[model samples]
Target: MKVIVVFGVFFFFSIAAVMAQPANRQVFWRDLQSRYEADSNRVVRVYLDKFGYFYPVNAIPIDKQLFLFPAREHNVNASTISSANLYAYFHANQTAQNALLNYYQVSQTGNFDRDYKKVEEQELRQISRQVHRLVENLQAKNIIFLVHGFNVTDPVSRYVFFEHSVSQKGYDTKIKPLYIEVYWDGLTSVSGTDLLAIWKHAQNNTRWVSLALRDLMRHLDDRLPFTIVTHSLGASVATGALFNTSSKWLADGNTHDVDSIASSIPAPVDVPIKLGMIVPAIPGGLTFVDFNHRSPDITTVANNIVGIAIGYNPKDYATSKAFFSTSFGATTLGCDHENELRNVSLALRGCGYSLAQVQQMIYPVQFTTPNIALGLQDHDFQKYMEDDVDFSLFLAKLFNE
Candidate 1:
């Protein structure tokens, strides 16, 4: 009995010890850039962090080495990656950078979309123009965006791990896929007591940040084939964007404001416009048309979508109703419903969607938790994206050439 007890404890810690670490952002990106044929070749990356002006204009990245909280296990010289050294990397805005480095002092909850300095028009146009130029220079065919969940109080930590994992899976697709990291104020710090309040606040913020994403989609050339891949609560950004299709500001179809111009973007009949939600943190009830009109008509959206893939795990208790939501919208338990897709399908069937129609538009990708013992980490995006065989297959379906 003593021997068995000792082995059980040892086994648990052993599994934890092998927890993965993100690759050096500097090294990984430099190698990616070298693969391109053009001398000015570089990955096109941009950022948007507007605190609910319901505004989402492109912003510049931090230039120097940054020490951030929720720090990764191995950051060389104890300095984490600086968002952008331009043509050479990834991105984060001023708000997330400050809130993360000073987490202990931050307010319990709210938006982190303030700017330390007013951005000049020329500065804002620089990266937007660079991205457009790079697309033409590198002959880039597709654009990819990564969106994170609500629990990530720290942006840099999530950025590193997300980008590195995408690279590990060869999901970046050489120069063909332009990767953009989208960061929003997701419950910037822990309140210590009211997790429910913080969770609801985080859920609400998605609505606003999503407006920015919606405008960005309008700004993006309709000619560009783009896809947004989200994890956990981040699904709201992609879903919300699809719902909020046009902007009055840019509705005139005239390109104003910044240098990059789109003469009124059109429907994606000519290109692939996809949205992937991996263990998404949303109410499954919303997928069907709610008669009260509480949620968007996702059933209608799904049918027109080129591809919308949903990744679910019955074992992801963190996203289970018992934990993720304590009160309102608790029943649907979006990530992994109690009855899984059966509930979603049955509900869809009630709404007049044939299971065949639901299956065609909404591709449900399954993730088999490697060990039931891992528990809550089962919802960990890193584990799903890096450690699971099912995630690899899901990625292939989402990023098919």
Candidate 2:
């Protein structure tokens, strides 16, 4: 009887030990770095600061053979520095890394390489032709530039979303997708102070982006039509940039000559922006002073331009409670937890527009759910995209019509 009892105790102890193993718990930086290094098709570069935390680096597809480097910086003020937060960041990175690897594989084995190379070579030869066409069409066309939201630790999400969205509407060749990813690798936690700090950092980063855009536009021989899309805290960043640009322009008597501006500013692409899309924008980020005094009247801005679409969902709990509470006064329940694209669609619908019209305006669409739940389940936008939601056709009708 004694021996049997002892054996039972031993069995229970072994089981508990197995359950407590590191692999069963959560993955951290070391595990992620190991997996990243082992990946062949995807390359992972780490930028480390004085602290142990690291930033992720990857390439964004620019042309067939060329890639734009998408660099991310870590938010040092993140609330939780625990193993769980590390796990979330790692999981996000893995998703992006996998997508890039798949892209590389497809590019190598399929016609992606051949087609892209052909396009590049053709583009090089027909630069003058394209330039001439652009100049001829320089009168005023609508162009939309998208800036991604916060907690986008992975570059793949942005690339996949952009690629799929652009491909859906055949804008892959016609429209230039200016993806301004301001990466401040924010830590996942439910702390308010930490979030505030991250928000401030994001605001600061906007100045750099603004300068870049201004510079990019100044050098362009022809200006194409343009719009700006910003999500989550990104809305704040975009607003900051716009406000700075407008202030600078006003200060300079609305002159486009920006040669004496700091070299850090991005050169402006010769693009004339006709519309601005503020999707479930965080209006709180703009203080009362800014809204009343400094900020441009978004409505007036829209009226003077082609159109402005404000995508919002009464069901988007996070945006409504956290972001919206800070931006706008009232917090309605209807727009809770809705994704960006869907919210944009709702905003358009509210303004008496049809789905088809929305689709004609924007291509390849994406939606995001609010991260109100505080757990592993909260960070699953990819899963939401993969679900059997007939968003493509629905979005097509909403934007294209």
Candidate 3:
């Protein structure tokens, strides 16, 4: 019995020793930049930070070392890449530069749409002009926007990981559309008491971010195409933004500001727009119904969208458990809803949408947890994007040429 016990203890320790090593081969951002620096062709990355916008509009490289939290303050930064010094590539191109600068400027003005700054009117017009220029530069009709989920408090880290993962999957070489990342404070430290705070933050941030996105869309040439891809809590944000699409705002067709010139524009067409939600951490119930009367519901958003794809893994307990335990007591959309379409139909009917419309727009992509021995691997972005997990293939198919 002593010999058996000794062998069991040795086996346990051996397993622990092997697992103690780092899971991912940590690829430094600098190293990744070096590989792309050959042409000295810089990618003008657009950042919209809601956490602490510490960086200024066209500020110097604050910190090069990558970590969890990068900066402090409430500002947005727009800068270009340069090969001579990859760390500080200031974009001189006025058109593209101005568009990015405008993004930062608009974000500084409070989270609500009603709190519009005087300068925001002119800045939004400038954004519309610059966005047109970007479309011409890229010569593509579709613009891809990536919305990240929780635990990524650092804008730099989120940008690095997202761009790196996209490149690794050959998205850059394949699709040449302009890419933008919506960075908000989706940060939460897991503790017994932290979940409630995190939930509230997510709800508030989603509303703000969604309004920001709606404003961005309103300003852009409505003729241009857009696709937003979101993961986890970002899925909630995206849904909230979609659900919160104001009928009055759409009817007004532009900002109500006296100084604004982009007013009276045509309402967005009910076609060609797409939203891809990956492992969304939102309540399944909220996706279709509008709690308010005569407000734009999921069907209203669906009418304007050509394609909608939602990716979820039934075994993502991290997402499922978090929402289930919350005060909301809501079941997450990420978990397997055996009657997902039925739920959609019922919700759609509540919003006055037919089952046929549900069939036309809603496409749910199901995934199983990867058969790995690692804990929490099911919820990790690295597992979804880096490893040869099925999610990667699903993404490829989702955005395939």
Candidate 4:
């Protein structure tokens, strides 16, 4: 039996490798990066300051080892310390940043490592300050942040492109909200067999990011409305920010399943937030009920949000086996949580939620049916994005349309 299990894992990963994204997909990601570079001033990107992402984030996508933002920076667009890009005309920041520094004649130290480290820190700080300023002075009162899930590569490019695509649909004209693409350190899997490890890694990253996100929220104007649209394990990160106020993870260096939130948020997410979870990788039991007295202070997932838009697939393959909990029906909220959602009102009552609030969680079956060409059992998020009907319904619910 052990031998069979080992062979099965290997076969699964082999298939996953075979199904890796095509070459054309790289073109699309690069195109978005180039476009964002050309008009970066117009956008706001907030990413976790953990490890570097799988691919380069800032510079034009090439194998030249050039990076726009150097290693260990907060932004996802950075190369590792050892793989630092050369400082030259062809490298990142050459045309714009290097030219400006040259104009000022900023003196550089003879030591290359010392000079580069100083420059990297300065660039990272400037990026952080710019994002805070934009958040403080947002033209739109309603903000929509897009967060992706585990094993997603080049998310910065993909989500920035997604923001542009959403705008092209007249969403920007109608909602007129500031769109921020959030990139977290959701570790990518080395192979399909590595899914479990990365999933756990992503969850840990979620906790760290949650605290940072809450801090970011504190900087924003509290009067404005905010919403988040998340897919897959991004659901955990979203919930942690809204409800898990405990910073024990910071002090103790280990995760505490803290979900109970205080009534007052201290100028941080005091208002109700609209959450859109598409194919989320959360446990159904936790979604509707606070089992095991995990949050004895009271308040569960049902209490944290004013409105929710849940996108599910009854035949979803990813969430079904994301953690090898299929037989136990443990966490496949994307597929096996309809009954749990129906019972969510019971949980909301303890939170003192209004009838209207209870009624706002929506999922229409018609919007969730998978297409034939797209694998019926697969959990590819692009399937949801490609289907106009499902995507529109999701957006409508997210913005309370």
Using all chains and alpha carbons, the TM-scores for the candidates as numbered come to: 0.58, 0.40, 0.60, 0.61
Clashes of each: 0, 56, 4, 0
Against the true structure, what is every candidate's RMSD?
A: 15.9, 18.7, 16.1, 11.3
lDDT of 4 by residue, 188-270 (tens): 55546756544544554565455445545554633456788887877766665555424323333433322322222222334
- Give the per-residue lDDT of model 1 (tens digit) for 43-135: 443333312221112222233333222223244421222222121111134454444324323332332212211211222344456567767
Q: Could you tell which candidate, 1 or 3, scores higher by TM-score?
A: 3
Off by over 4 Å in 1: 1-50, 53-128, 153-175, 191-194, 244-271, 288-304, 321-334, 343-354, 368-377
Residue 8 lDDT, candidate 3, scale 0-100: 30
Q: lDDT per residue, candidate 3, 245-350, as tens digits?
A: 2332223232122112112222244335677877776665445554222122233544666567777776676565633522342435766445443565576567
Model 1, position 59: C-alpha lDDT score: 27
> What are the lDDT figures for the candidates, one per model?
0.48, 0.34, 0.47, 0.50
Query: What lDDT is reached at residue 77 by model 1?
Result: 27
TM-score of 1: 0.58
lDDT of 2 at 146: 51
Kindly list the per-residue Cα lDDT of model 2 for residues 16-68, writing each as its tens digit: 31122111111222333344544422211232111112222234211111111
Query: Which window of ten consecutive residues has the lowest lDDT sum in model 4?
Result: 19-28
Descending-lDDT candidate ranking: 4, 1, 3, 2
Please say which candidate is ahead in lDDT: 2 or 3.
3
Q: Estimate the TM-score for candidate 4.
A: 0.61
